[model samples]
Target chain A: MLKQYSFEKTAVQTFPDNVSLAMRTENLQVFYGANHAMHDADLGFPKNQITALIGASGSGKSTYLRSLNRMNDNIATVTGKIWYHGVDINEPNVNIYEIRRHIGMVFQRPNPFAKSIRENIVYALKANGIKGKAELEERVETSLKGAALWDEVKDSLDKSALALSGGQQQRLCIARSIAMEPDVLLLDEPCSALDPISTVKVEETLLELQKKYSIIIVTHNMQQAARVSSQCAFFHLGHVMEYTPTATMFSNPQIPVTQDYISGSFG
Target chain B: MEQTNFQLKKQDAQSHEWDARLHRATRATRKDWIGRGISYLCIGVIILVVASMLWFITSKGIATFTQNHVSLWKFLSGTNWAPDQGNIGALPMIVGSFAVTFAAAIVATPFAVGTAIFMTEISPNKGRKVLQPVIELLVGIPSVVYGFIGLAVVVPFMRHLVGGSGFGIISATFVLFVMVLPTITTMTVDSLRAVPRHYKEASLALGATRWQTVSRVILRSATPGILTAVIFGMARAFGEALAVQMVIGNAAIMPKNLISPASTLTSQLTTGIGDTIDGTLPNNALWSLALILLLMSLFFNALVRFIAKRGQLKNGR
Candidate 1:
């Protein structure tokens, strides 16, 4: 565990400084029992820019994302130091719920609660103790509009969220995440399960969200990485091989591994 | 000439091959029908057993309910239940069953739910393994043993304190509380555990406290399952015979106070086990009274089923 922690710590040190570093990790190592998932990984996510983490399956990219909000706490025996606004998130005093409120996550699968569409949007607000019917109604409308789903679901706000189409459910999840007005949004392969048109719509939503929230999206689609992200980081076997502007990373080719991955030689 | 000879032989061989293939298909079809027949036979057997049990209860107990004018209403609303006297009131017994079960539920629900939460969500890995086997063993202990313990220990203790006939609603209820606790506790835990992990994570991510998440998200989602568990416990409490009968003082009169000796429906049946009714009229009425009890139990069961059915539909939606 100690050795793996240092491995991630060294990896995080390799990134260059950017103007708006929303979240910074210094030597983050994650372990489940004896297996080391993420080696010394260091990276910085800039504000208002869509940063995409691209890697093959089992490359530790998702592990790094979950560690940001301490979602890994439930897994038992994970070691890492994640820094958000200069506070070490691993500190005993650091509340995980508060961290997650600021850094919301959208899962790969659309997991709408067994609740009405309006209630789904209002769940987070109610959890935060936001009441008053008028305020709740306004926030629900705004969040749905922000997610680009209001026009589609406005007439049936009272209908069950589970009754929505797959694409709509994923978008509803997005609305739920954004309703909290989080500082950073973490999306783990959000469009991997959707059809092509739905994928395009979700990508567009992510691009629009980049103006307000720092977005870290993990995608297997290189074209998507090229199209949506402002910056891209390529991870290989728990190591961050390259981090650069998406244009440069895709066209110019900084590292050999990144080039190999793009050319489809080996993941 | 060559074509004529070869074609004729080929046609003959082809007809034989087709005949063999058709024979094999018929055998396979017969096997499938036999398999389906066996499945249906098993189902039929189960349905038969259930129907026969209901039939037997109605046939035997129906006469007891239709015997006398006093027996019919008196069994449910009468102030006294005594076969020795011409009067056979069932109100005291009904009250006895309800009071004891209500108290038992009040005593056990919180403890059961609390234990369930600790076992499923809050307990450490090591503790979780210990919890299941312990609870399962608690459930396996026989009801007769429970009766003996209540008689030897609880009745004497109640006598010293609450006074009265020593064996009364207080002792019977205390024993029922212990008896019914495992049912609610186990089911509550199972239901809470059945809720998806996403719900918990969603609540946690929103900065809510652990207690808040459990109360708002976990418990609310698991309400139907927990309610079903409580309903099962209620059924068990009402039907419990030996343990409650042993502890409750066999007084046929309705108690004016909690300390007074009282009887339950089961107790009345046991106390009046085998005196031939004055005639078939009294016997039939007695059977009807028994049927009424059955109806009451069935009513509560249907209520639970209704709640459960609605919960299922909502979840499906």
Candidate 2:
């Protein structure tokens, strides 16, 4: 039997006035047709830090993450303010294509184009009107190194990406996204499909990436959140139930729903 | 008492049920046999029919060379085609077939790809609701109707533009273009739609514009399928007879220019078959033309299969 918990009593942490945020959402309500998926999810992500969104399936963690860069523009109706660089990017008139350039995204599945690894990394670069051969080669080397895939795939940069293992393909996807040099990177369960060894490698890569890019990840693994993220947000039934330091959320959850979820009593 | 009785029943059931044996044939089994028999019979009949047709055509086609003494090289390279005067050079019809087929495919490719892209990537709902039926209707329309329209409208238009009888290669090409456009466009749309949705999402998430995503990602990935569609369209154009015949004027002569009258392999076969006597050289030569058409279609099918296999390999499927 699942116990009913009160939705009104919640604990949401807020940052200090001096803390610079990479992005934030205010009164963010998402609707798929008439189904309200997310409601008033006001949260701030600190700059240059990893923030993990943890929840059960269909809890709107992915919906909220996708909306951070307006990836849900045509798929759903979002009525809220997504502030990035002090501009409300949720506005309809805003250029989403430009917004995506600054805030790249990685999907749960590694969708490497059916091209060579070099071509995969440089395709978006070429599309953005960069044509210098030496520059493209440089970016390819750096981005692949950044994603920690260069050492393994350096010899076969011309090889088809589909030839890579699941973990390698996921890293290549990360490399593809980061090749654009985005400010903030959003990952939607990026490591869920990976094995333990690959997961560790990806986690290590994420830790290394934190020094350069702000990271926001949605993960189902609580241990992963505690291991990687500095701050953690736990979502339940599309509501932001708890937001606190990763250690505190796992060690001492301030709410009943979060406590049960962490204990694996229910999700 | 009831428990003991149930245990005894279980023991009895287990002893016999656990033994390996087939059940008695029921009415359903009879019906199953009948259904299987019917399907196998249909397949057997079709295979026999096709094999016999191949045998008939090949035997009759080869009689021209073995019995009538026409050189294969001369027949292929000969510029003149007159069976009555013992000049059975079929180069004009061969060239005419290729010209109309190539011309139609070249003109139809851009329009087909554009329409396919519009249907798949741009306004897909409009494409499904409005354009899909229109394309299907075009496919359903009989070739005779299309040929009649060409004879009535396109021929006169060609006459006004080029100042000839308007029955020539150009007119036949226009007719074949209309006939093959739907075949190519529909297949192209299917191919474009077959591209995985994730490729588009990945491209868009990289901040690529819609046009950039479509041209660089979607169209590139669909290249094999699109090429197959073009080849299939060319095959259709190459084999179309009534439509080309209505506009080609059936001259059976060398096509001096695009505006001059000529005949395709199919056109000559259709019109000349009725004029020649049975077991004669003229009839056997016509059979040879049919053989060429058959070989060309088989080549097209082989090409499609090869591309599909290559595409599968590239995708690592």
- The best candidate by lDDT is 2
Which candidate number would show the highest TM-score if scored against the true structure? Answer: 2
Q: List where candidate 1 sits over 4 angstroms from the true fold.
A: A1-18, B1-13, B24-45, B65-71, B124-127, B274-286
Candidate 2 C-alpha lDDT tens digits along B197-226: 999999999999999999999999999999
Error of 1 at B135 (Å): 1.0
| DockQ for all candidate structures vs. native | 0.57, 0.67
Clash count of each predicted structure:
30, 0
Which 10-residue span in candidate 1 chain A carries the lowest summed lDDT? Answer: A1-10
Per-residue C-alpha lDDT of model 1 across residues B1-317, encoded as one tens digit per residue: 99999999999999999889877757779999999999999999999998987786687665555434444555568785555565666677788888887888888898889888888878846436887788778788888899899999998888888776688888888888888888988898889989998878766665567888888878988989988888888888887877888888878788666767787777666655565554554455455556656877897799899989988888778
- Let me know the DockQ for model 2: 0.67
Error of 1 at B184 (Å): 1.6
Q: Tens-digit lDDT track for model 1 on A138-172?
A: 98898888788999999999999989988898899
Runs with alpha carbons beyond 4 Å of true place in candidate 2? A1-4, B1-20, B23-35
